[model samples]
Target chain A: MATVAAPGTQAYARPALLDWLTTVDHKKLGILYLYFTMFFFAVGGILALLVRTQLAVADSSFVSNNAYNQIFTMHASAMLFLFIIPVWAGFGNYLVPLQIGAADMAFPRINALSFWLLPPAGILMFAGFLVEGGSANAGWTAYSPLAQQSGSGMDLWIISVIILGVSSTIGAANFMVTMFRMRAPGMTMFRMPIFCWTMLVTAVLQLLATPVLAAALTMLFIDRNFGGAFFDPNTGGNAILWQNIFWFYSHPAVYIMILPGMGIISEIIPVFSRKPLFGYKAFVFATMAIGGLGFSVWAHHMFTTGAVLLPFFSFMTFLIGVPTGVKIFNWLGTMWRGSITFTTPMLFGIGFVSMFLIGGINGMFSAVVPIDFAIHDTYFVVAHIHYVLFGGSVMAVFGGFYYWFPKIWGRKLNETLGKWHFGLMLIGFNLAFFPMHLLGLDGMPRRIATYSESGWEALNFASTVGSFLIGVSMIPFLIAVVAAFMRPKDQPDDPWEANTLEWGTTSPPPVYNFDELPEVRSERPLFDRRHPDLAGGGH
Target chain B: MAAIESSPRHEEGMSNGMLGFILFLASEVMFFGGLFAAYFIARADAQEWPPVNLLTEEQIAAGVQLEMHVGLPAIATAILITSSIVIQWAEFQIKKGNQAGLIWGLFITLAMGVIFLAMQMYDYAQLDFGAGDTIYGTTFYTLTGFHGAHVFGGAVFILIVLLRALGGQFSAQRHEAVRACSIYWHFVDVVWIALFTILYIVPE
Candidate 1:
């Protein structure tokens, strides 16, 4: 509180390690978020490899059913709760301030609180493994009756997730306020960077949707510990209520996971294509539309339960695709007839577009009533999700890393290594998830420990191999990251001839972010500054 | 680090902190909204809301009365409403540069908050139904219990504000913390009003 109102010049004189622990600077906190989430990403990836290995052969005894359930449940919980959801906050914390030309988030202490919340929550959730019954094995969805039956580990999972939700809810407020109030002079709502716009929308979704998850978690907790039956239909409660409330938050949570990645792609694609985002305003509005429509389509996930309005949810699910499709063409149009550069970020951005296209088209199949009934819990639904989440969001995360590496660290990740990482991850991602599509159609359900001779062995083996391939791909990314930090900070500001305000400052921007912000005559203030001849700037 | 200068700040309509606090309150609404949704869903789905037949044998034998008594909760509600006024008055005192008035107003408000919490506890002790007795008891305790927790939270907030006021921290132009406290206190009050109506006044 004292530092916020009056930051002493000497206050930064603390030892480096202590400085980070006590720091409220958005950039440092952002870096902390990245490190924390990426560690969980690795943990989740390892858990996933275990899942794939167990399923490699039919009726194989690699792991017991109990172990298998714990593995996959923790895998999804870690990936969704620890990695995908909050990783965007990492990117948002660092990039939002820089992109919008603010020195820090609107409330720096609150921002620190958000980042600090994640570590304890992540640890507490994973700590379930050490307990007698093992961590939350009722699946990440943790449907009631099943959720109620779990050991103390499930309670830990619930409490920890509620903590995480608190983190997210408050963090959402911070992002909203930062974006709303802290943009550089003349950077209107429409003039903000595409990434910031996406983050703004993501924050809104988080703010409105996350608390509902908290509520549902609270009810589940009460049902479990307090002998309440808010979700137990046998005891005057509805079982479907959990699904209703859970998906209400979780469905929008899917968007919360992906939208920022889209923002990253939007930022990367336009830059590498050497043009402004083809429809910047349209992209922003489309983001808002996706957010608006995200809430209405939660029932699509529940279609098989016979509890939802099938046609209405079906139609709303399809309607979400409209705005998404608009953004896809916007990307393509940006790349059309432009001086394109296939830098690592650009390559991953392109990968995101193509793979997300597949992801989108496949979701539409499930959006249809009959098709969903056929593939409800099958590998096909699993495949659809992996395509959207892994193929879509993870790709964007990597692209953002490579895209912003120089700006963040004042050194570029080696492109050659980056390309290897990109190619292997892409191939490995597709190889792993794509077979589930066929396996689903062939009747291989997801979340199975093993199965009898169902003739689905071949594709399952293939998917396992692909999962290992995805694991192997991480080596190059690691190497590239290590190699980059070993080098001195040598990159210049605006290294790729970028357009956003962040590029107007030094690479590895200073503590205050900017010393002399440019006169923002347009969205591309730095670009206008760079190309004085084109300073009449409409784009 | 203090070496890093803060960004230039300019916000209209509401201070950025106030706006941020308002947004925070909005999230709180959604949190309560989730509870309300569950309550309504539970109510709508039940053949009879209390579903007293579903109660355990022990609860039945223990004579867990499934009735909403309005007298005590109404008093608690009134206490909270009055505290909301007192907190606002404290905020208004700072606005008018009356530090003594602000301090007294905050002290009175905190006392009222404590009394409301005490009344809620008394209500809980007197109630025949336990939290586990039925869906009626479950939602009843869940909703009002959360509101009571919030009242405790607001009391702490007011306590802090009172201490800050005594320390001469706030005045006519600088009362962001007080203002934030005021907003939160009011939000908690408003949520209680809704909770009181839905849980106590409305017949199952």
Candidate 2:
């Protein structure tokens, strides 16, 4: 037999650094995603800490108003665009192909281009802080008139968002083609895993929603820089026009964040509970219903602005809770009767459920027209958003990382350190965000650099302490991840006794994914193969 | 390795290039849908558009900006629409392995595409209007300017396919590049038809 290069050596036939830079392999791209997203996570987290520290004391001049404005603006911008979205894309990049039993994405070069655009987009957004006037201070929403007055920083923000939008659009298209065209034989659409289904829906939403935002931002750029009257009221332009266009995209964008997290919980709850997913068809329908209804309720965000028809939007907004409630029950049903395993991933999944419930309830309150008028610009709104975005989406993302680490790296992360990390994060996250409810109810306005000296100080101080704890919690998690990587050993292919097709192949799967595509007989083919008797049994 | 052997390469069921073009057209529809929405809303609020009664002699001496921008574009639109027919005929001929008919049809279509681009640029240059002139002028330029950019892209695609056909690079079974270019050319033609109706034919 002719001598053959080692697997890793064969994977890298050229210079190592260039191979990584230009690599199209899904596993390597996944690692790149993990590294890039973690970097932004750290940066966005620091910004969160700074924002919390400034809020810790009442009417104290730790940072100026403008500085505080920049901090909050950059923090939201970084977390939403830089952190959460990329993290989901990263997870999809790493897992979707393996799970679906495909060799690679249909458009591998486009996938590489899509990922490369993200870092530059992040840098352009952050570069606003270094500029003369400072970062865009119109908050993450960047509403018109206020956004229009924001000088060059707003222009930079527009440019950055458009770039990020292009990246998401390309990635979404690549995902659609791959999912539709590249599935292995017998991997019919319904037989695919729920995670892949969620991804397919998320890709559709991204492709549909992103272009509208690009149009809105392009119009805004024209109004600001080129004296066009698109959103300029004084020039016969309507300010409410921006609201229509912004929410048209922003409403579906919320689903773009949560659907993947919902997919994660769907994947985890069934595995840890050692049962088939409850109401599988209902779960699929619920996800699609959420995505469809997501587009119609965008006007709900404009309840206070009164530009939208309130009763219609309010009813539609509250109607969303039905499908969302179905998913929560599905998870609960999944865990009802089984030998439940409480891995670190499971703990975070549980954290997501509890936190997302609170978020959903608070979101419902905002759907009431009068209640929104009361708390529209208050810290109550801030608390509700973070509960959903941070507590819901971020928690599930971390759980996904924990669940998939062994498959990606060929080794399991140290469980002791993982538990430590989870414990600290759970406690710290609650301490950080839970007090904001009380503070918001007590009449502390959000986005304020300073506040009156009164009852708010103590809770603000508690929130700051919690934020620091959250920051400190990352150490053990990082260490656990590093330790897992450094221990050069291969895990059993199915380390977690997982049910998906991804676990059917070797850990740290070969560059082209499976050597021979497994025949997909059911949604959980691997589980069926591992336990034939339990294959058709109900929970 | 043998277990992972490749499947017999039949004709691709749906060519990659064709799928890409179709997807591109779907996105283009959404993009223009936004502009059309804006236009309808703006028009609905106004009692009249272009305020034709308010058109002063001096403004008309603004050299009938509409005529300057759209007169030649209309001719280009006719050329593009006819070229779509020729390109479709070429695709039909390609399937029959009628090399002479295929080459003749492709050459004519490519020539029409070039003439269309040249005429659009001439229209842009002759118009005295800039972006900041008025809402009428602004919307007019933005809509037409974007359509012009799409035309330029289609022309480049047509040129690439023409060069490849000349080199005999496409077989009857493997001519996805030609099929994709035809679909794209048709889409560009469809967009121009809409643009011509809204921007030029309809009373603004």
Candidate 3:
């Protein structure tokens, strides 16, 4: 067990490794999630570096084709499954209960169970590299025919993913129940924090979508091991069936990955701008609308598959943009007429909006079926993915870390270092991904180990440099984190003058989050507490 | 501190336990829904039932036939449906403070559930096809296999409740576990009925 010295007193008995492994405290579990997901983030980042290094020069032999396939597949798998998807759970596990003023999550033991499932599942998924035929090389999508060609690693990937899906599905139900039943006295559904609303919708998506992924993986498992023919074309099975089921779950999964990041941005933007979230109810409805539309537009990914209904999926894909546009404008509107502070969190929040816009607009281009036909397997799609995930989701993740670091750890990270990290990341991000759009437009395909076209060399080289820059940008962020840990814990509770219930407690909150919460007459309970004279009548 | 205990955090409208169970059931529905979707796709894509042409020519010549017998499985379905009724009876008896009747009802239901499972295993052994046979065999076995596993889970749940009932752990107002078990038993029963109808009764 790790122990921390009590300040100006004897050493305190703190939770150690075994305590973390067995504890059901939402705070401890949340910390575990943060540590675990960030570790995977670093791992996935290294894999990304390996990929960029391989692609630094044309016809470079830094790694074999098979190795590149494994590298990129593992990269996407680690990022999507390990880092981005679960990181929200990390934040939600910590903040949702605090934000809603509950004692803990609805099912704290199940919450522990959910957290514990990840390590074993993640280890199993990655352990495939040590197996006979190299790790799963079917891309993260692991499309049929190609997916069936791999060895025991494919089996390991399928089983690990199914286990991970179960972990997420159970965790989703926990979040839903916690939000629905555990709000503080006057915290009505509409008055609930925007982050809570987003978590609720994200939970619903996880509950419905993850099991379908589990089922698809199950069928694939049987097909591989038991001679079942769910994806085999030679055995009276339809190969397109795999695409349909995979996308059905994965399209909603896209929301599961990003919506919580949007939630984090929503929280940070309102707090830093010194205002209430503009159109709170509209944001809630937009989130719900996005979750709903997310399910219908999955076939958009199937546009180039030739097995989907192009017109219907295209229209539905376009329709999702409406609610997303609502969120974008709502964010901008929040910052429109306010005392804005460009804290590191705010910069990342604003970065999410601008970058996600490009991602959304480019996604719309894919919905124009003819355009999709051209860019379907090209680096343009790769650029769009990173823009949405890295530019949007990764930025929000850092924003969330900066915003909540004080509250969670009870110390302030160096502001200057944070800004440096944010600037480097933003510049490095665009430099890395932006040129791929042009390279893809010029007909360079994705997932290949090397290309013969020397014409594409300069841009590829530039992209590699940017990728390494993004890698280097993490140093300042890591140093900032370490420096924050080294400092004494003296942050005041409401460092950002945050609006929600989480701010009503201590900097590092007590085991039970609050001694007594403020009166929640509105969504901005803390704000209302700060200015009681204007509480009931304020706009 | 006194006020904190009486706060609205503890005053939720539903029991967290029951709500959690219901939400868990919802995910189970989607899991089963995926298998059903696969079955529908395979059926829609097929020009024939059982898909015998999918087998190799030599194997076909050697009389490796495929068939689904509904008669015995129909009996098993009846038995499962009866167990669902008996479990509900057990819940009603406990609600009325008739612990003796509750015990008997659970005993009967548990017996019926075990018999249904035994009959299923026997039926699987008797079938002319396996999961490896064809798309038809694959879909059939996968759907029924998962449903059977759920039934086994529900039976274990019932056995735990039955032991608890015998130990006099539940009263009229304190039978949440018993009620949860019944809900799960009914769900498993309903799934089996759907599986029986789709896998056995439906014609090509």
Candidate 4:
């Protein structure tokens, strides 16, 4: 056999560093998004550790109250803005074009601009801590009046968040154009990959919801800086208006964060189970149904505020569960009685389903107005948020990482290391967040620097242990990634026998995605290519 | 890989740039929708616009009363709406392959845009309120101020299109930029009509 250059060897014309910084190629841009968001993930993770340390014991003095506030605020902000939201963009940027058989994103320069906007926005947001009165301490929601209570850092938070919103909005537009206009010859709307469908829905949500958020942020900025009274009740402005507007965007943002993760899990389950996605059409409709229903449920977040229509929002909140349930059953059906492989990616895929169920059930509980009144601002709500966001989104993020790592880098991650990473993260995630359920049930309020309740300390301590364990879990994942990179880029075109068009191309697909795409007769084009005898028959 | 070659590799749809630009406009609509929502909420919550009772005499002395003077804004609205037509005329001219008409149409649209902006600034100067005065003033200025910013953005977009038109870079079939600019101008005009009715014509 002819000798091949190593995977990381200089294969392109420009020097690697400048090539990356200036390149508008979707794959390179996607890589940049991954590296950037992952770095923020580590930063956000460390901040979370600081938060856990602060709340570990009764009246814990691990950090000062102000510092604790900033840490937790930054933790949420970094995770939500810097990590979770953009990480999906990272995946979509890399995979959507390849999966749809496009050359690059529709607006590649704007694609690069979208990624470039994040660093400065992140810097401006985090730079708040160095300024006077510390960073925004009003929580990530940055509710009005309290949001205005902070210093210039809050200003930075507002401006940076607006910038980030602009970035997401533009990115959403780019994705919509790419998916709508760039599908290959036989890839009909219904025939596209499930992940692309999810991105389509997610992009629609981002396009519509994020701008409302930018408007809300603008109002808050004016209120804070220009003596405006949008949320200041003393001057005839209503605080509930802020809640109304904030949740209007944020409620859909919940889907913006989770749907792509669901998409990733959708891709993972099918590949590992050796089955077509059960109810592929139903799954796509469920995703769109979730997107449409997402807008109506914002008031569910404000049920305790006493200003919203109670029964209407409560009913809508419960109603959203119907489509969500459809998705869960569909995922299970895909894996039912199939040739299931418990690869690391599949483990995380299964992890997402199980954990997101608990999250969904708890969320539904909050939809009950009476139940929400009790746990509105408590650790129970915190637990639910983390379960949905961390357990749901973060798990799928890892699953996507492992599933696509080979395709991206042309080398499989070490399987033993992968299992170790998955196992530790599973244990550590449950250990850390599961106790928050009890702590919340035990009357533990959220966002407090410390707790003084008699019986809450043990669970709190357990949570701290779990959080650090989760932190420790990342060590193996990083090692797996690094170790994977150390090997040669020698993966075949179809490493996992996957079913998407992305697998039809070379591992670490060339600057252009495909040389010649296989004739797409079904959603699982690669599967059809590999098993022509099984074509048009159920596997 | 060099730049992706422009070819009909995928099935036919709107050009990628036009589709992307339209999506951008969709987001812009939502952005304005948010401000309008805030405006309506503020209006619904308030007992009165320009609450003279809430104003101190000293504040009244500081030029913070609510003399809306809808006449100027109405005139500006007409001007902006007409500019949308003028820009559409430019697109029509380009579509029919009339280069000179395209140039003249774009120039008139650009001039109308500048005049509308100047008229708006004039209106802002003549107003007897500031954004910090009350929720009414805050909502008023915030809504109109953001609209004005969009107007400025539209003008800049027109300027770019005009410059391209001057450079003979557009034709009947090659005027995607001109068409995108026209669509954006129409969107701005529609938003202005909504803003004018709510801010001026409505009996709040």
User: Per-prediction interface RMSD?
Assistant: 1.0, 2.7, 0.8, 1.1
DockQ for model 3 equals 0.78
Model 1 pairs whose backbones collide: A233-A237
Q: Estimated TM-score per prediction? A: 0.96, 0.93, 0.96, 0.96
Chain A TM-scores for all candidates read 0.98, 0.96, 0.97, 0.97
Error of 4 at A44 (Å): 0.6
Q: Is the docking of candidate 4 incorrect, acceptable, medium or high quality?
A: medium
Write down the TM-score of model 4's second chain.
0.91
DockQ of 1: 0.69
Clashing pairs in 3: A2-A16
Per-residue CA lDDT of model 3 for A1-539, tens digit only, reads 12233355334345676666788989889999999999999999999999999998988999999999999999999899988988999999999999999999999999999999999889988999999888899999999999999978888899889888988999999999999888889888888888888999999999999999999999999999998989886777888888999999999999998999999999999988998888888899999999999999888877877888899999999999999999998999999998999999999999999999999899888789999999989999999999999999999999999999999999988889989999988899999999999999999999999998669999998899899899888999999999989999889888898898888888888777887878988889888888988796422
Instruction: Please identify model 3 stretches exceeding 4 Å from their true place.
Output: A1-15, A537-539, B1-13
TM-score, second chain, candidate 1? 0.90
Worst 10 residues of 4 chain B by lDDT: B1-10
Q: Per-candidate RMSD vs. true structure?
A: 3.8, 3.8, 3.5, 3.2
Between 1 and 2, whose lDDT is larger? 1
The per-model lDDT (C-alpha) reads 0.90, 0.81, 0.89, 0.89
